[model samples]
Target: MKAIRIHEFGGPEVMQLEEVPKPLPAADEILLKVYATSVNPADYIIRQGGNDLLRPLLKLPMGLGLDASGIVEAIGADVKDFKPGNKVYGVPNFPGDGGYAEYLAAKATQFAPMPHNITFNEAGALPSCALIAWNAIVDLGHVQPGQRVLIHGAAGGVGNLAVQFAKAKGAYVIGTASAHNFDFLKELGADEVIDYNTQHFEELLHDIDLVFNASPVRDQSVRMKSAEVLKDGGIFVCSQLDSPFPAALLQVLAAKNAIGTMVGGGSISYTSSLHGTTALIEEGKVKAVVSKVYPLAEVAAAHRESEKKHVRGKLVLEVAKEN
Candidate 1:
């Protein structure tokens, strides 16, 4: 099998396309003939060794991808849920990343049967981003009907899905994106769209039931601004911890008897959690929006495009050509 591996951590140039041995499945795993895979920020973070805790666990010369959709070529002896010809989509576990290749093995629990309505490229784009949005909004945020939810970076992968998920829950969704994405966000069911580049979101929106920070803002002062728009006891969830909070903000929350919490790490347990995303896809409430596709040899270019931070949706790598 040919795979893209990064022997050392650095820029996009470090990713190398090389011929590697095909992976074999464990007793509870399945070997997939990969059709497509998507690139996520986690892939780059792992490649650049940005997260120290995950760095040590990363195998040297590791394969570079997290999400994939393909046909099951073989299944381990203990796997009964899937068969050799089943279509599936899943995220490979960290420290064993191998999606950017012709074939890779994943625990059966990490994948779900692909929906019949979508193409392989679209299926491949859903696992990581959709799972993150599902976990954040539906699980942790506890978004409900009639609620007002604000999503930052609404044009990005998770943002696009987050908007749809919130709307599907009957919430009035507000999204923050540049001017160019306003129409796109509206089409995705965003009730209100704010141009973050020109306007201060905190001043324009208030009493938000939930605020989801998907951008990479890490400053403490900057992060606390989201609290300004929250209603009393409202939830402020952020993917990045480096958000700024004012002392006055804490006082306000304390006076109102409200709580604030920050969360990171969308890594699924690869057990029961993956099933939830699968069900959502099958039900047609959620959809993967693939913005671009690159061939196996163009993995480096795909990464470069993702780094621009202007991509409207997910970017995928087609590991195998269609028949």
Candidate 2:
């Protein structure tokens, strides 16, 4: 099988397309004939060894992908939920990193049946981003109808879905994006849109029930400003910040008596642990927004596009063309 793998971490140039052996399913896993996979920022971060603390866990000659949609070609002995020919989509286990290939062996619990209404490419775009959004807004934030929720980076993959998920729950959703993306975010069900380039969101919105910071602004200063916008007892869910309070930020969070939680946004354990995202997709309450698609060989280009930080939605790698 031909898959993209990087023997060493560095730049996009390191992602080499090479021949590799197909993976076999373990007792609780399923072997999938991958139809499509999507690129997440975590893919590039892992490629560069950004999270060095996790280096010991990530094997070398690593495959680089998190989300995919495909058909089950074979199921492991203990996998009773699915069978061969079942259409499925989910995130594969991270550190294992095998989605950039024609086939992957994913734990059965991480995936869910693909919705009949969507295509494989669209389903492929949902897992990582949608799961992050769901875990933040619905699961942890416990957003309720009539409450106000603010999502930073509203036009990006996770933000787009967060907007939709908040709206579906009947929360009045506010999102921050560049001026050009205002209409797009509004279309995604954001009740209010802040142009981050021109306006300070903290100055304009306050007493929020939930604040989701999906941007890369992890500095203590920025977090301090964000903390000001939350109502007393409100929750702030951040993808970039650790939840345990890094001593410095702990002071600020304690000053406001606000709740803080870190949502580890991307997980490969979706095939088993995060299949709930698939149920949301199948139920039509949520949908994946794919802003771009590239062929398998152009994985580097896909990474380049993702680096732009202006992507309105998810980007997918078309590993296998539809018949």
Candidate 3:
């Protein structure tokens, strides 16, 4: 099997496609014949020495991918929910071997049956970003119907999905991106789109029910201003779970009697998250926004594009073709 592995931490150039031995399923694992995977910020972050939580668990020569959609070639003896040949999509193990390979043997619990409405490339794009959005808006933010929700970085992968998910929950979604994405965000069901470059969201919007900062750039000033727009007791959520919540932001939340939280390795089961997203996708309430698809051999180029932090949606890696 060929896999993208980084032997040392560096740039996208460090990711090399190398022939590696195929893995067999463990007692509770599934051997997935990967059809596709997608790049996320974590892929680049891990390639560049990882962060506090992941650095210790990572070893050299690790496969690089978080999300995958594929067919089950084999299943371990302990696995019961899926059988050979089931189409599935989910997040593979993190800080360990991942899905940027011809096959991946991961715990069965990490996967769920793929949504029938999407292609392999689109399915591969959903897991990590969808889970992050689902966790932020549904679990942490507790976004309610008719509520006003604001999403930062609304044009990015996670932010795009966050906008859709909030809309699916019946929230009046407001998104912040560059002016060019205003129409795109409205098409995704945003009631308002603020051009962050030229507009001051704090001055323009107020009494927001939930503020989800999905931007990868960790700007404390944005968080402080975001807190200002929240209604009394509103929820403020950040996607950078690894970073500490700023004290001043907390103080602002405290003054408003609002809640401040971050979306981390969520406690919800992967099965539940994927299943919910699958339902929404099947129901036509949500869709994957893929910016580009690269062959497995062009993964380095894909990483380079993703690192620019301007991709409108996911950058998918085609690992194999569906039969």
Models 1 onward score TM values of: 0.91, 0.93, 0.98
Evaluate model 1: give its TM-score.
0.91
Deviation of model 1 at 180, angstroms:
0.3
**Model 3 lDDT tens row, 106-201:** 999999988898899999999988888998888778788999999999999999999999999999999999888888899999999999999899
Best candidate (score: lDDT): 3
All models, RMSD in angstroms: 2.4, 2.2, 1.0
Q: How many residue pairs clash in each candidate?
A: 8, 8, 0
**178-232: candidate 1 lDDT, tens digit per residue:** 9999988888889999998899888888888988877643445545677777888
Quote the positional error of residue 296 for candidate 2 in Å: 0.5
lDDT of 1 at 180: 91
Cα-based lDDT for every prediction? 0.80, 0.82, 0.91
lDDT of 1 at 151: 92
lDDT of 1 at 134: 73
Report lDDT (Cα) of residue 179, candidate 1.
97
Off by over 4 Å in 3: none
